[model samples]
Target: MVLAELGFDAGQILAGLKPWVECESPTYDAAAVDRMMDLATYDLVAAGATIERIPGRMGFGGSVRATFPHKSAGEPGILISGHLDTVHPVGTLDVLPWRIDGNKCFGPGVMDMKAGNYLAIEAVRKLALAGHETPLPVTVLFTPDEEVGTPSTRELIEMEARKNKYVLVPEPASADGGAVTGRYAIARFHLKAKGKPSHASWALEDGRSAIAAMARKILQIEALTTPDCTFSVGVVKGGQWVNCVSSLCEAEVLSMAKRQADLDDGVERMLALSEEAGGVVFEVTQSVTRPVWEPSSETLAMYDLARDVAKEIGFDLTHGSAGGGSDGNFTGAMGIPTLDSIGVRGHGLHTLDEHIYIDSLVERAQLMAGMLMRLA
Candidate 1:
């Protein structure tokens, strides 16, 4: 029934996702991101959502929270949370414009989240248009900085999640078409080293290379990695010239663990590596920390509902954990029942080939609407 409602609206759904993809809301580009927010706000307002705009001050595009009126007022509502940022840069669409050929629709940001974000609107819009108002309230959250680990939107996501009965994150479907049931704990560290600079050819003996110390630290830190928990160096910068021994070096380290104790232990071990360098300035400090989101009976129960919904829509559904993090992490950490990856079926996320299965558009929308009806 839900699919038949949305079957005629497939083109409309793709049309909705195109504007957001073309807006090119990279997290670093504040103005571009704001455009995406504006577009979403306009659509939500037209859908009868009461809009609350939160200005982003930490050099971000800010956030938008829209609340749709519920039929009854006895229970907490639902929060559908996602972000507008993409890993692709501004000119990505110039090369990989949105197009549908066979089963695929290719474009940047379409798979990672823009498609998912727009699909939520389509879900609620379908319900409203069908004259099916939910007794349980509904809310949607669009943030600007989720692609870069949600630095600006964590608190807002948590605040909204704590007040809601459930959080549904519209990320992409898993590689095997499963929903994300849990996510690893994530933490970031910045390492820096400083030493005297000298000409490599003329004063080689007088120079103490920060690069050398950094290399040692990188190797030692990487050796501590395991299958479940691991440390990775994402960014590194240090030398001035090929002929000179550089005086400064810095690196961004990312660590993930299944448990809090393991994450804490990993940080302590990495910090101990700073003592390896006596002559140079070796320092390790943590920058951001997102606690682990493990599955609970509550989340598992939500997945059971999702699984039944997917089956009704003619698909087999599975659930698992992801190494990466999402806004769901904030809500799940607060012990709110959370479910993720209910977007269109697609893969190659965060890449130029990012796309969604064209046929899954209606199916996912119907599934979302069905879940809303059943839960409400």
Candidate 2:
């Protein structure tokens, strides 16, 4: 394989990726994510790429934009995109410690993304070391808040993507070693339930508990799930003291739909949920949203390029629309040709057992290098 000819070393790649996996960059922790950005910046600099850092906004960590030097610099080229944040919070390493068992390597964000991002970095680094210039200039954008639907970075993502000819997302490859051509539309909502506070022992009957009201709202939100649109409550916070009746409760809700119209209807229904139950008022506010990206002819053509690369690398690549949303959603929805989930192959995403196959390191790196060299 060309990876072998290029001296791609799985051991070296895994060693280099260990620090990223151990970084523990949960989306909400700006400091942790910034540390990750710092790490990536250091690598890009060593790869001889010019670096631009955009400080975080909307209470999120900053983003990194690295541009490789080429004769076609300042022209439309390939945009290599990914995120530094993982859904697993800090200290998840205690349970999902980095370990290599058989062909699988385990860590908090190994499969979901850290490995893929590292692969992109390594591909550029190695290609530079080999003195090979890609047919087009390459730019890298690493965001810090994709885990929360990219509330702060969506506009930045789209803006940077608009300057590129194509976008390659290093999200985790599918279970069947496939790529992502389309993504479901996703919406987020903030829910609040308010009630009268009183002494629980003396006026429990007189006071309406917001926690109880929130519980009822959760059930209602769950019942909104269907074959077309699915809703779930992911975060909830309520009472502060046991002796007092809770006056306020809050929750974060997420909804996903295969079609834009279904997601629109779901958002309407979610916002229409304002009501008062026994003096406890329930209110919902829409938050960040990801528009549905149906596979366009351009996107399918990009996937074909990826498939051809995989075949040359001695593997078969398949692609389909997936449920989870990535930064690809923004680029694809904007009608930019995008190939996503073109990272390492693995499973157990967003779980304690998240990991990647050990051998996929060089294979994916080869595919990335091929795309960089072949895309014009």
Candidate 3:
């Protein structure tokens, strides 16, 4: 389906994008995140969206929701999700200046999400400029602290997702620029072990070492993995010094399972192991950060819409499943038709080399605008 050509001012959009990149809104820095939210609020309002700011817990950045109300049919809106926070801390912006070289723009949070946020803004702007009234209302949910598991905004995301027919997530496209159709479910857990401390040289046999117990548990968890299910112990902390027996140790484990049942099974096994270890008191706390984005008829239809939009723009788009998780995972788990990886393609997300293709700024914006026009 051919929608009206988007009236995109690429230069102006880029001009708005630069300052956003310069604002270093890290996850834990509430003040910096508030500044980024203010910029987004201003831009969205200028583009005719009604903005709402949701305060987050202390020490964490808050979230913003912008609604572009459609005057046509007044149906349940489409939800566009993106994060405004980066993985970097407050001082990162000074160290990592935003720079452009050839076709790529590099800086903190560029590829990971800030670029995606800009694309969403530009899409809404183009639609407004083109005078395409959506049949359904459209809402853009921009959250800070997604990099830290979205604890504060998870309920908000779920509530908005349930009210919408479709959810579009602007996470950066895969390395090949294909859309991600599915993502694995993630359950993050922290395992803490407590034991009696003693002098290592004299009473080693009399005392129980939590660190030794943790090492054994780590190896056991690693052996429980397969191709479909994966587990990793990312962070470990314990031991006061080399001379004394450790009394406490904690390890953070990330578990990925294809299905919820698999996740349950994995957790059960872990709990069993924790119980089996002698002389060690174990505590396990699990959080379901993102559920798996399984394939469904609704998801396929969403992909069809994206493919149609891509074809209209003289490009063919492909879809793939991924192991990484996003808020899209939550929407997909809710049984909504969710299309992810709808943003610019680049490299080094969550790393110092993060960058976005400069050309994708225009192309992906057009694609998003076209899809919204047709779908709405």
lDDT top scorer: 2
> What TM-score does each of the candidates earn?
0.94, 0.98, 0.90
- Tens digit per residue, CA lDDT, model 2, 1-376: 2655777899999999999999999999999999999999998898898999999998999999999999989999999999999999999999999999999999998988999999998999899888889999999999999999998988899999999999999999988999999999999999999999999999888889999999988998999999999999999999999999999999999999999999999999999998887999999999999999999998999888888988988999999999889999999999999999999999899999888999999999999998888788
lDDT of 3 by residue, 92-189 (tens): 76767788889888888888888888988888887777776766778999988787678788889989899888898999998888898888878888
Winner by lDDT between candidate 2 and candidate 1: 2
lDDT score of residue 258 within candidate 1: 87
Lowest summed lDDT window (length 10), candidate 3: 1-10
Selected candidate, larger TM-score, 1 vs 3: 1
Q: List lDDT for all candidates, in order.
A: 0.85, 0.93, 0.83
Instruction: State the lDDT of candidate 1 residue by residue for 1-376, as single tens digits.
Output: 5556544377888888787788888999998999999999998987788999999978989899998877664358788998988888899988888888788988889898988888888888878877888757889999999877888888888888888898898898888888988888888889998978999999988888998889988998888998767999988999979899888999989999988889888888877866535579899988778888999999999999999988888998899988788888778888999998888899788877888998888887877787777664
Worst 10 residues of 1 by lDDT: 1-10
Candidate 2: TM-score? 0.98
List CA RMSD, all candidates.
2.0, 1.1, 2.6
